[model samples]
Target: MIHITRTLSIPDSEIQEQFIRASGPGGQNVNKVSSAVQLRFDVARSPSLPEAVRARLTVLAGRRINQEGILTIEAQRFRTQGRNRDDARVRLVELIRRATEVPELRRATKPTRASQRRRLESKQKHGDTKKQRRSVGPSDG
Candidate 1:
């Protein structure tokens, strides 16, 4: 089981992993060994996740998630299969943990009187500067 937060734990059965030949770092062994790990998790149907977390996870997964709601993460950073596998699982847990956090709601706020006055004063000062830069006309005193 992978524990994402205090209240959330995802079972191993929820994740599926496939090994494929990787193209980086291993040199001659790269072509011979299937070191890359492809991990997939079904976010839409997982009972371990709350509905809110599932929705946010889908959004956070972006192109990684298919239409079937399976989130795919490919890990090939390391030359060894074991490291790649662990990396993928760690990434999945981190992603789930991020989704578990609820963003703070933004409350509408009116500009304070002081700030409004300052803004208007700045605008007027700018306008005065621009007015002084105008070309002197023949009618000017």
Candidate 2:
């Protein structure tokens, strides 16, 4: 089981992993060994997540989640399959933990009187500067 938070724990059976050859760091060994780990988790069908968390997770997953609602994470930073696998799991847990937090609601706020005055003053100052740069006309004499 992978524990995301105090309340959220995902069973190990829910995760699927596939191994593929990684392109970097291993040199000759890279061509022979499968070091990259592809981890897939069904976010839509999972019974472990709450509805709100599931929705947020889908949004957070972005391009990682396909039409079937499976979140795919590829870990290839490490040369060893074990390290890559662990990295994938840790990333999944971190993503889920982020989704579990409730976002703070934003309250509507008006500009302060001082701020509004300052904005108007800046605009007027800008306009005055532009006006002074205009070519003088004979009628002004």
Candidate 3:
């Protein structure tokens, strides 16, 4: 089981991992061994995630989540499969933890009267400065 928070935990069975050959650093070994880990979690069908968390996870996953709602995380930073697997799991946990957090509600606020007055005053002052910069017309009798 992967514990995201005290209240949130997901069973290990939920994660599916596939191994593929990684392209870097291993040299000859890279060609022979599959070191990259592809971790997939089905966000839409998961019973472990709450509805709100599931929604947030979908949004957070972005391009990683396909139409089938599978979130795919590729870990190839490490040359060894074990390290890459662990890295992928860690990233999934972090993402779930983030999704579990409740976002603060944004309250709509109006500008204070003093601030509004100041803004208008500043605009008027700027307009006056620009007017002063204009050349006087000959009709100024």
Top candidate, metric TM-score? 1
**lDDT score at residue 106, model 1, on the 0-100 scale:** 100
Candidate-wise lDDT, in order:
0.94, 0.96, 0.95
Best by lDDT: 2
> Taking the tens digit of each residue's C-alpha lDDT, what string does model 3 give over 1-141?
998999999999999999999976878989999999999999999999999999999999999999999999999999899999999999999998999889999999999999999999999999999999999899975
> Between which residue pairs do clashes occur in model 1?
none
- Please tell me which model should have the higher TM-score, number 1 or number 3: 1
TM-score winner, 2 or 3? 2
Q: What is the lDDT of residue 18 in candidate 2?
A: 99
Prediction 2 TM-score vs. true: 0.89
Ranking by TM-score: 1, 2, 3
Candidate 3, residue 79: the lDDT equals 88
Model 1 lDDT tens row, 1-141: 988888899999999999999875777999899999999999989999899999999999999999999999999999999999999999999998999899999999999999999999999999999999999998996
lDDT of model 1, residue 116: 100
CA displacement after TM-score superposition, residue 38 of candidate 3 (Å): 0.2
